[model samples]
Target chain A: MQKRISIFIFLLVHIASINAQEAKMASIKEGSFVPLYGASSKKPTVVKSFFLDVYPVTNEDFLNFIKKNPSYSKSKIKGIFADKSYLAYWKNNFDFGSANPKSPVTSVSWFAAKKYCECQGKRLPTMEEWEYAAMADEKRIDARTKTEFNTYILSWYEKSKTYENTIGSTFKNYWGVYDLHGLVWEWTSDFNSIFLSGESRKDKNNDKNLFCGSASVNATDLMDYAAFMRYAFRGSLKANYSTRNLGFRCASTTKY
Target chain B: MKKITLAILIILSMQSCKDNTQNKNVTKEKPISDLSIYNLPSQWTNQDGKNIELKSLKGNVLVMVMIYTSCKAACPRLVADMRSIESKLKPETKKNIKLILVSIDPETDTPQRLKSFAIENKMNQEPWIFLRSTEENTREFAAVLAVNYKKITPIDFSHSNIISVFNPEGELIYQQEGLGVNNDETVNKINQEAEKIR
Candidate 1:
């Protein structure tokens, strides 16, 4: 009878261990805002109502994800799906070493992050959605004009390796989301959809050769240096490329 | 035993479904390389409204470029560049190759629309293929190719113009960026890859 009881407990524990982590989501109301960079004719782009994870996907959540989808594990991921440094901080295929499990998972490729979101029946937030939600501070939804909000984001930029910190350690924003700043940079669904001027300048004498209609996409707010940095950083990345300070969270269109 | 049977049933069903859709000569199955575009499982529709997997195009060297049909600026030049590349390759080399134009604006560039565009551009030929897929797949493909594109207005998009070359094995071997740039190197790469096919 004792053995039977122990077996039942064992089954329960095993099932619990394998279950995927379901992060809490914040409902963002649809709104319009002119972004610092990307797809602009100096007009505000409308972001429809959607749901976003309160925090970036944590190391613990990712660990659970890989366990369920073994093909996406550190050693097993295909070269086309990720670069050499995918999950480079991890000790092995399964172990994350001494890193806190609650810390936001960094060094993850866009493909891996996209797959994680898909498995959860979600997706990586669009560039516009991410920028819109990220603009919020504790008090105001659109805090891009605020000096303190800019300082806080820029300060986090100067601080090296804040990805080591646990999720939700930063202050919650107006939209009830955390770690939009003061944490690792994130992967968005449309990260590849940015055609910035830096690359256009590199196009070198042949303006229209590199991009179609490059003249139209000028930044509406050039003073928002912090947001500009984000756009520039996103432009530099390829899908398979992974970095130590980059991670991602999933978003869904449905509020549920 | 029942589980194994069920899994086999699923696999069989998937295979049969695939076979019905793709009606080309995929003679022998080869192990897809990890770096191959065939590794992507996204389904695509051709100008003829036929469904295809990227793997089905294996054993033929591919020269691919992305363009939206409605674009007034770069696409025409991009198409001209593709045609020039095709023209440069020997007729024998062209037999072993497919020049693919994938649409970035899938909603605007339907199979019927793609067909009209193909006819309009005089690319409605044997070697020229026009393809479109779901928005997600199109985005994923663009990500793989490192082609940055965003919708500016309801009708306009800002997009990078790059022509990609893939070997017969579906691995991207080379890329020639920019519109109306020299295609000499791009042509050479295609001819070299196509040589190994037959």
Candidate 2:
């Protein structure tokens, strides 16, 4: 009788893991758009068809992740991979505490988030893929130009402690993805590609000495100040650093 | 017989639960500092096509820079800067230091290409190593170095000009940012770090 129960438990755990590995995701179609940074202003970067998580990764999902990958657990994590504040809100390695189980996980470093996605057999979205999917509002594919669209994002930026909110509380975009803007900032696979800030200065406006090809890749639309803020935020980040208002979701080239 | 099978099954499931973390954290040496680059688990191939991990290079002070062999704009000057730093080092310090050029454009800068570039640049000798890895690993490595780069065209990349110095323990000690900047501070730091290594 004990042998039968053990076999049943094994099968149950295996199925549960398999389901976690394949979470809810939205299929994003391929298209082209000029981003606020990283390409020549006149040129549009093409995004291949991909899958994105419908919502940001929640504290519940991440707890499952750390249970399996304990090297990333709070105590065992190498200092090179994450900063001191990583998962600071969680009570311990196994529990996220009184924070809502369904709330989006925050204070995760780029390395931890990257590993979480890789273990899922997926990868983090490129900055371009992220910006492309995020360009949509509830009704339109390209809504950056709309006053209401920009206002909503800008207001979310003004709002304090939105990271405490649950995922999918925000409106779904054109691609059926949620919380691209209203939730915490996310880590991109190539967030380091952006070049702005201290590198640019007087007479250094096109500082070829500090960075290569900076002259040609100015912001395509200065009016999209909202996107510019995201680019600047990415520029300021180091991979090992984590914060209370930062979180991430996985993306994949193939549908699961 | 059923009892034996179930025991094996329980053991197997426990091992599987530990599988993900086991593949990483390959090195458990107590002395390796938490901030050391040796903690990175990625594998890399050198100009000679030998597989290496950052931990294997632990005993030498590392003077590392990221560049693509194909870069025409800043890498040539960066290469000159690296050579200049090497030239100024004392023979004793040279014994303890390795000047490394890591490739950001791994897709095009194959081991063969790196070998030829090393030969052409007259860097195919002691203390100069060229390394490349998978694109994902390269990105992760770049993140560690805080070196930012992007491909502007099919054949060209835009990258920052930075040379990072790490102590023998694989902890980053100093960084020289910008092209053709003063190397006095960098060389002194390298000498100072190398002196401690011996």
In candidate 2, what are the lDDT values of residues B1-198, reduced to their tens digit? Answer: 677688767755653233333553554655677789987778999999999987799889999999999887889999999999999998876899999999999999999999999999999998999999999999999999988888878888888788999998899999888888889999999999999876
The fraction of correct interface contacts reproduced by each prediction comes to: 0.74, 0.64
What TM-score would every model get versus the actual structure? 0.90, 0.91
Query: The CA-based lDDT of model 2 is what?
Result: 0.87
- In model 2, residue pairs whose N, Cα or C atoms come closer than 3 Å (at least 3 residues apart or on different chains), thus clashing, are none
Docking quality band of candidate 1, CAPRI definitions: acceptable
Best by lDDT: 2
- Model 2, which residues run further than 4 Å from truth? A1-12, A199-206, B1-31
Q: Residue by residue across A69-188, what tens digits does model 2's lDDT show? A: 888988888888999999999998898889988888999999999988877778899999999999999888799899999999999999999998988899999999999999899999
TM-score, second chain, candidate 2: 0.87
Q: Write the per-residue lDDT of candidate 1 for residues A1-256, one digit (tens) a residue.
A: 6765675576566445534356799999999998877645677788999999999998888987787677777788878889999999899988999998999999999988998887676889999999999999998989999999999999999999899998999999999999999989999999988777655325653646688887887888888999999998998899999999999999999964
Candidate 1, B91: how far from true, in Å?
1.4
Kindly report which residue stretches of model 1 are placed more than 4 angstroms away from their true locations once superposed. Answer: A1-20, A200-207, B1-28
